[model samples]
Target: MRGPVRWVLWDVKDTLLKVRRSVGEQYCSEASRLGLELPPSQVEAAFKQAYRRQSKLYPNYGTAQGLGGHRWWVAVVKDTFSQCGVKDGATLEKLSYNLYHNFKNAENWEVFPDSERTLRSCTDMGLKLGVVSNFDNRLEGILRACGLLSHFSFLVTSEGAKVAKPDAAIFHQALQRCGDPASSVAHVGDHYVNDYLTARSLGLLGLLLDREGSTLHLDDVPARHRLSSLDELPALLQKRAEGG
Candidate 1:
């Protein structure tokens, strides 16, 4: 039989918190401050394109290529604005730099309504919490700024661990830190592959947080393993503890 969950690993982005404004809106707002006029829709489309290209070119913040997180993001921001027809190099540099630092602060992010209550419930249940995110080193500061850092026992980032999700190494790093068996831990995140399947493959209970029912058509995701919000978590754990 599986052991009762003693530890819970969380995914930060989209799961616990998200940007206060859409990337396009934020980018356009920043660009406007630098005297560039661009529609939010156009910037958003360009951002999607630039982000895809950057991810393809420099996967996982380009750590292997030595670009590192900051430079990788700077390149993405530059490409995003460049695609939107901003030709001034100084403007691109200033915009990218501003955006990079802007996201590091709490004003740029908002915690999901269900996040803190669920976290507190988990803590009350005696479960140890830790973060396993594909984010960079700025995560601790961001979490701290949001007043959520104290809830976690430890924070592991792709930049710090040198590994990202969908790869088991980062999860292993978190497991090592918690010193718990995979069967005794549960990982929750919004991605079907990165959060659920990957963790399940490593023998940890994987809970997919499908807030929008995006994965409802997937036969691989059953009702028992999927959550529409973090609010469902504590009850699910209670059920699992009761061998349901």
Candidate 2:
């Protein structure tokens, strides 16, 4: 059946792939190898603190092309380790590089159970697909390694767009590449602000894939726009087409 959505834009990471290891767990492992004995929980806490600080310091950081991406992550890693009591400059540098490099491998991630089937079904229904992500250039390598790069015709990363979601620039860039009207596009992502509301504000259908059903109390999002998984997507699109 025909659908109102002509294009489906995806958000990578938790939306499509579940990162098998937490960043803190991975960082703690790396630190242990370097003789640092930080608690995993402490490392996780530090990582979050550092991440928030870094994000503020460098809004739309890693999405930039070239060395800016590398530098941005290096700063984050440095701050993360700093929080864990690793105060040496050279050690922080080595750890940051290794962590960044390690994430390029697909083994560290797992595709969501409904991801492939949903992508295939959408493609079969003639809807074009793309990705709009706040991630950096490493996303392409990670997606290709995970066997998902081919499913998307294009991806606009924060590095590539010079901006991240919750900002209209990235969405506009994706729309330009897909060459579709905003009304014909729907973006599926886990973040209520970055993924759902931002796309909706831009005139695209923004569906929240609330796999954890964590935000039921939020009154701003309609029940119809909330999805537990991509499995319900095609049926929902059909309903939208029928003006439900």
Candidate 3:
């Protein structure tokens, strides 16, 4: 189901933008720049493994239970390089930290043409916009780099939310920050269960931003709107806003 879309929350990585070339390419280049002699595949694999473990712990972060994703990412970066024989010194740590930290905001990252066009159209149409993403890096930096920051008045990261996606708390924070109820907000993102189901479960209108999945989800979010591209959003919101 669709409605007036008082607010639209977006996902950052695959939905709004993609990395330039590939992780292998950047890992190799960045590693060489830091004077590391490790192979690209090996360094990239370790880095990825570390990131996964770190991002999984956001829910327990400020409480007595868990460490948040950023610490997880830093540890992963540190260990990955240390295992490759790089010592845990300031230079090595800074190289790993800032290289991965700056990856999203770097000039070479690519935003889908349709994404830029749609975001512009939506903002022009006067719809409130914000971002709710599970990220290690500050999302605002990436949004600013993409020239899309002005479109958003609210942007919440896992750091602020204190939990990652699939946890309704983060989405709730985005909604609260945007000054809307879940019923009037829409969440558009790529992942099936993580983004769509989580939003739908909270009674927010959830749309899966994937070209495939014309079929319904086995769990919740089944029958939710499916958008092949963000290009369709302006029209979808237009219809809802006018009660057409």
Best by TM-score: 1
- Clash pairs for candidate 3: none
Candidate 2 matches the true fold with a TM-score of 0.91
Q: Assess candidate 3 and give its lDDT.
A: 0.74
Q: Which stretches of candidate 2 lie over 4 Å from their true place?
A: 1-3, 62-67, 242-244
Off by over 4 Å in 1: none
| Tens-place lDDT digits, model 1, residues 11-61 | 999999999999889888888888888999999999999889988998888
Question: Alpha-carbon error at 127 in model 3, in Å?
Answer: 0.6
Q: Rank the candidates by lDDT, best first.
A: 1, 2, 3
Give the TM-score of each candidate: 0.95, 0.91, 0.84
lDDT (C-alpha) at residue 46 in model 2: 87
> By summed lDDT, which 10 consecutive residues of candidate 1 come out lowest?
28-37
The number of the candidate with the highest lDDT is 1
Candidates in order: C-alpha RMSD to true structure = 1.3, 2.5, 3.1
Error of 2 at 240 (Å): 3.4
Candidates 1 and 2, the one with greater lDDT: 1
